[model samples]
Target: MRIKETIYKWIFTIFAFASLLFLVGIVVVLFKEGLPIFKHVKLVAFLFGKSWYPTYEPAEYGILPLIMGSVWVTVGAVLVSVPLGVGSALYLDELASYKQKAILKPIIEILASIPSIVFGFFGMVIVAPLIQRIFKLPVGLCALTASIILGVMAIPTICSLAEDALSYVPRSFREASFALGANRWQTLTKVVVPAAGSGVSTSIILGVSRIVGETMTVLMVSGGAAMIPVSFFQPVRPMTATIAAEMGEAAMGSAHYHALFAIGLILFLVTLVFNIIAELISRRFRIKLGLNR
Candidate 1:
């Protein structure tokens, strides 16, 4: 038994170490390939410049438009998904019967399993035309369309995590709230949600992360225009879309190639920061709720 336990511990430790090493390796490679761009283009100009004409006569590599496009679509996705996802989670955790939950949970999971490319195609074929017809836009492929698709993709993740958080609240908390004459809505809003605030916040952050990092759906739906978006109806290209669309054409050792890697590095840092913030917020809330002993 001791020998078996020792072997198992070593195996798990090696696996965990390998995972960490892999992460570090990726960061090292990203920085190595990406930092070369800074030698040619100043970091400030590359990050803040408005133009992104990589093939034009001086090969501008500004990424501000890409950043803004990503931000616009991600914000739109968060606005659309958060309310619906959280509400669905609340219903599943508090209001739904066992049978309803049983049916709906699998359906939600299935939604997550659907390929992102399928969502992109659906946006192109179904949602895009509808938006064009309804809004009288010249084209439906824009930030709004991308947002709607990304929102749908983010829903299952948000719903599942938020439901799990809600479900983790102690039964005693609910009983006490009820004993104090609070109705279901009041108990849920005031007591249960507060108790699971950390997890709920984490869920939201993770959902945002999902929207921000998504590539294929945004690439197919976001119109592929490398311009600063002035409105939801305007076509825009996000960072992920730019990298995905242009990386193939860029020469392996060229400035454009390095610039793409730099964009990826920026994206990696953004997502990493978001996840770290989520962890910090979760920890802080857990401490406040006395759940972090």
Candidate 2:
């Protein structure tokens, strides 16, 4: 038994260490390839410049438009997904019968399993035409379209994790609340949600992370316009889409190639910061809930 336990521990430890090493290797390579761009273009200009004409004479590489495009789509996705996802989670966890939950949970999981490319195709073929017809827009491929698609993709993740969090609230808390003559709505709103706040927040952050990092769906649906957008109806290209669309055509070891890597580095840092904030919030909530003990 001792020998088996030792072997298992060593195996798991090696696997965990390998995962960390792989992540470190990726970061190192990203910085190594990406840092070369700073030699040619000033960091401030590259980050905040308005133009992104990599093939034009003198070849501008401002990523502000890309940043804003990503932010707008992500914010739109969050606005659309959060309410629906949380509502679905609350219904499944609190209001639904066991049979309804059994049926719906698997369906939600199935939605998550659907590929991003499929969603992209659906948006392009089905949703785009509808939006164009209804809104009288020249094209349906815009930030709004991308947002709706990404929001749909993110919903399953947010709903599942949030439902799990709500389910984790101790039964004693509910029982005590009921004993004090609290209604189900009061118990749920005041007690259960607060208790599961950390996990719920984490789920929301992870959902946003998914939307921000998604590539193919945004690329296919976001109109691929590398311009600063003023409205959801306007076409825009996000950072991920820009990288995916241009990286193949960029010459190796050229300024354009280096610029793409730099964009990737920026994206990595942004994602890292988001995860860090989520962790901090989760930690605070855990401490407040007395779960850290």
Candidate 3:
């Protein structure tokens, strides 16, 4: 037994270290390839300049439009996904009948398993035309269409994690609130939900990470316009979309190739920040809930 334990520990330790090594190697390569773009353009200009004509004469390389496109789509996705996801979680965890849970939960899980490319087709073939008709727009492919599709993609993640969070709230909390004469709604709102705040927040943040990093769906439905977005109806290209669309065609060792790597670096850092924030929130919640000392 002692020998087995020691072997297991060493095996897991090696795996953990191997994963860390790969992460570090990726960071080093990203920096080595991406840092060259800074030599060609100032950091401020690269970040804030609006133009993104990498193949034009003199080749502009500002990424502000790309950044804003990502922000707009992400924000729109959050708006669409968060409320619906939370509501779904509340229903499944607090209000649903066993039969409903049996039916709906599996359906949602299946929804999550569907491929991104399939979702892209749905957006293009169905949602886009519907949106265009409702808004009387000339084109169906726009930020709004992309955002709605991404939001749908994010829903299963947010709903599952949030439902799990709600399930973790101690039954004693609800009973205590009831003993104090609180109604079901009151207990749910002021007791159970608050107890699960960190988990719900983590879910939302993770959903946002998915929304921002999405490539294929956004590339297909976001109209492929590399311009600053003024309206939700405008066509815009996010950083992920731009990278997915152009990286193959960019010449190796050229400025464009380096710029794509730079975009990836920024995206990596952004997702890293979201993950860190989620960890901090989850840790704080665990401490508050007395799950950790």
Candidate that scores best on lDDT: 3
Q: Per-residue alpha-carbon lDDT of model 3 for 14-71, expressed as tens digits?
A: 9999999998999999999999999889999999998999998899999999999999
What are the per-model numbers of colliding residue pairs? 0, 0, 0
Candidate 1 collision pairs: none
Runs in model 2 deviating more than 4 A are 1-19, 286-293
Which prediction has more favorable TM-score, 1 or 2?
A: 1
**Candidate lDDT (C-alpha), each:** 0.92, 0.92, 0.94
Q: Which residue pairs does candidate 2 place in steric collision?
A: none
If ranked by TM-score, best first, what sequence of candidates would result?
A: 3, 1, 2
Highest TM-score model number:
3
TM-scores of the models, in the given order?
0.93, 0.92, 0.94
**Candidate 2 or 3, higher TM-score?**
3
Q: How many pairs of residues collide in model 2?
A: 0
The ten-residue window of minimal lDDT in model 1 covers: 284-293
